[model samples]
Target: MRPVPAKAVTTSARKLADALRSGAQVVVLEVGREAGEGPEPRNSYLAGHLPGARFVSFEEDLVGPRTGSSGNSPLPRASGLQDRLRRWGVDDDSTVVVHTRQNPAVATRAWWTLRWAGVEDVRYLHGGLSGWRRIGGALDTDVPPPGAGSATVRPGSLPLLTAEEAGRLAASGHLIDARAAQAYRGDPDRTGTGHIPGAHSIPGADNFTGGELRDAAALTALYAAHLDGDEVGAYCGGGVSATTTVLALASLGVEAALYPGSWSAWITDPTRPIATGARPCGRTAAERPSAG
Candidate 1:
């Protein structure tokens, strides 16, 4: 559906309210840290949910096995994902709106996943569930069981990147690392540190202001400052966090692609080079930061 224009994309509460008042026939999809006990939804749902929100867990719904850390998400088998969506009552025409816990990175993955599954009209609730509650939105505790009718899903090309792709991005001045600075420099204490070689950091948190997305002008300004005239490709620890950067670029109408495997996949390659310690702007490995 090309996503109803970025401006038309609705917020969490407003979308829910619209669904109820206008009976827009949309499905509210909540992405939480974990799945709740039983099929009756969880804390978010019980604590006043939108009229028809169905909750799903990040671990159970968003990803599958870790594969010994080779791949970041390692998408679940197509048949399994399809069956689960069918159980969730999603169909060909369902306007599936996804909400997560303010982690734009994780939420973007869900958005990308659904889109990759051929589910059009998927949108992310700006600022996620927390923002909805802050705005005093209404909620429901009822857990609607999955409906009948199977969802036939056709998997599309996964937008994941490989080591060679990362290398090309590095050489072409395009790769972007979306991790915090401490982590981006290969901080020893952090589980994963150091960014893709030639990749520059542009933290995803820059996309928001006062807990909501900043205006489009701000977005364009921010990205323009960091991108350095390269086609942007975002990546984080395991591609989960990088999606947030991709979303921000989208908000600015930038043609940025996401490296789904991201750092996790990059590090796993063993053949890829890893840079350590901090470097100043306009500096690469072995280049000392100028004191000027």
Candidate 2:
């Protein structure tokens, strides 16, 4: 099958079914819950999955560690990713669809992680597994072990920024912080309040409500209002939350980028400039003002 352009996230259940009907080898990844939790599929998944869905735990399999060094999600290295993809039977041409438990945030982290490892035909299930269940799709709690097939990544598929690249792009207004208004304003004491020196606030939460994406018209308006379709980058505290915005834009058929390192990386360097109190670059808060 000729590889199509990237898939959108809205109405993703139907889109996933269409992809499956196309007879393309699809790998459905379900981001699992935190530890000590049972191997239960999310409400979305239990109601119904898109068939042949596999499970990957977010905390255990996805995030590596919280060491202050390295990218926030600190990708588990391309070689490890390559091995995982191969085990999952993902070749160069596999169309991997990711679905999480209602929140697009966790799924986006995995999406960005695969992109970092050179997986191009990647997408997230809009509204996540919950959305699928809402639409009366199918589900599978038992995930099969990975199949036997290894895949190699092309060069630059993982075009991620080191702290320096992040700082440079940030200083140039190319990197946008996609956390909530309050977090960007330093209302949350997770870290520094302000954004990266020249970074703009474009919170990821604006993507949806009740596990469904905002309407296309609303998405277009949102993107135009915040991004203006410029060279954009999305990042949250640790790079997980920010992917929600990326997923949102992709679902709207808009091309947005991800910083991956996000605010965590910015604060790593004590010398890096930080901004707080309100939206930088003349943009107003998408929500309540952050308490700087």
Candidate 3:
């Protein structure tokens, strides 16, 4: 009911097909990890994918080049995004549906970026291609010709956090480390892990089970337990999974800032303190991070 209670996610694959059939200026985008878990998911798209769906590279289209202290998937430049949106035929009123084969992070990243770039009707496909195929949707192999869209991007529709603001959030407000529990607790296998001090551990995996996000009531309860702050923010290995947390927060009517650099950037400065174990620092007035 009401699209699963989140403004950002669509729960029914068949309903999405209905929208496509009705001709609602909709566009489907497939995205995946850059290096990928094994073979990249886009390879499947190359073989056959959702009809009219275009592939958006997580590395090329979604993220910027890793500059000083930048993470693996930092936010892409708005001008570059504007050009890409034009190529994809996205406009101010376009309904963008982003999906991924591996996980929801990629889709959520694209959804958040489009919303941040001021697109009003962005949503994440509930179960991805697997769900689409299950609902009698058809796939096509041919790459559709690019549409000539004139959508100009205006940024800052959503809140953003720099490395400095993130540090303050971890200390003074609520900073969530949206990574695996092991990573949050400094897993020995991952080099340079151990979350930012004062941040809370909230794995992105908890938001979804078997590729479907939990219901609104469940999410509200899950988040209310850990969150009761004036401000809230999120970060992850890079910037991808953090969007899931942002989406989760949005479902509960909470707004959270994103730390695009996240852990990868936090570790760049050898001098920064690292916190290990599950407990949060819980400080009220932690000093803000200074720009070097």
Candidate 4:
């Protein structure tokens, strides 16, 4: 019997194909946001996706309903997510692979969410649909029958941070603001203006090149300054893009927490400090004042 993959955070399309051929118990999820207006669910998955791949809505399944105080992308309810996971055929021993068309952030969001939900063997499909096509993997329009999975969702398998904790981490540890540089610098024209005071500006896009994650050495150098921080966390406009940073750090064997509420939630409370301009608060991670 072929051994099932274990502890891998990302899988290439070729490797995934081999695993499937070997009869590994794997569930492939094609996650993305709805497109176009109107009642019909228009998404790339509707056109075509990996054979046996299930569609997971980025807007619906991955996030909870927004409230006045909640961020734009609040974490979904665990029980609700559990039901959806089972419907998607995830089981206790299933090796779940998530992917999207081109946007790596969307796919990584699913990866992070599944990990947070305690799906033990979740992985991001590197290069997404394009990679699959490059490897001559077939796409199927037929939706497979709903799965019968006994997987239980226990949230917080991965580290998470609240607004307060994110703020504190920025001051003492390494808190990364993963929005674009303009947004991080509080461009007047951008939404969610400014960043959490003390957060470092490290756009999530930098982690990828040509729609794929950069090599580990590049990632290491990109994040070299903060790699040794006592603690590390990441946040973005609504908590969507920051997952890419978390994913990149994870690839380098670093466990950086996600600030799910992120900037959207931070700005809701006027009392929370917001910093603007190019400079981030404090210096390098080693220079940060110890939490006493």
Q: Write down the lDDT of every candidate, Cα atoms only.
A: 0.66, 0.66, 0.80, 0.84
Q: What is the Cα-based TM-score of model 4? A: 0.90
**Candidate closest to the true structure, highest TM-score:** 4
User: Model 3, 2-117: lDDT tens per residue?
Assistant: 11233655546887888878886788888866455448657877887888889888888988777878877777899999999999999888888888887888889998998889
Candidate 4 lDDT tens digits, 204-292: 99998766788899999999999774799999998989999988888877888999988888888877766666888522233333555
Pairs of residues clashing in candidate 4: none
Q: What is candidate 2's local distance difference test score?
A: 0.66
The segments of candidate 4 whose C-alpha lies over 4 angstroms from its true place after superposition are 1-6, 34-43, 188-192, 282-292
Model 2 / residue 216 / CA error / Å: 3.9
lDDT of 1 by residue, 112-216 (tens): 777667776677787677777776776677877886535577776335456677667766756778778767787433333466667777777776664456777
Better of 1 and 3 by lDDT: 3
Candidate 2 off by > 4 Å: 1-11, 18-24, 34-50, 64-67, 187-191, 225-230, 251-255, 281-292
Q: For each candidate in turn, give its C-alpha RMSD to the true structure in angstroms.
A: 5.0, 5.6, 5.1, 6.4
Count of steric clashes across candidates, in order: 4, 9, 0, 0
CA shift at 234, candidate 3, in angstroms? 0.4
Q: Is candidate 1 or candidate 4 better by TM-score?
A: 4
RMSD of 2: 5.6
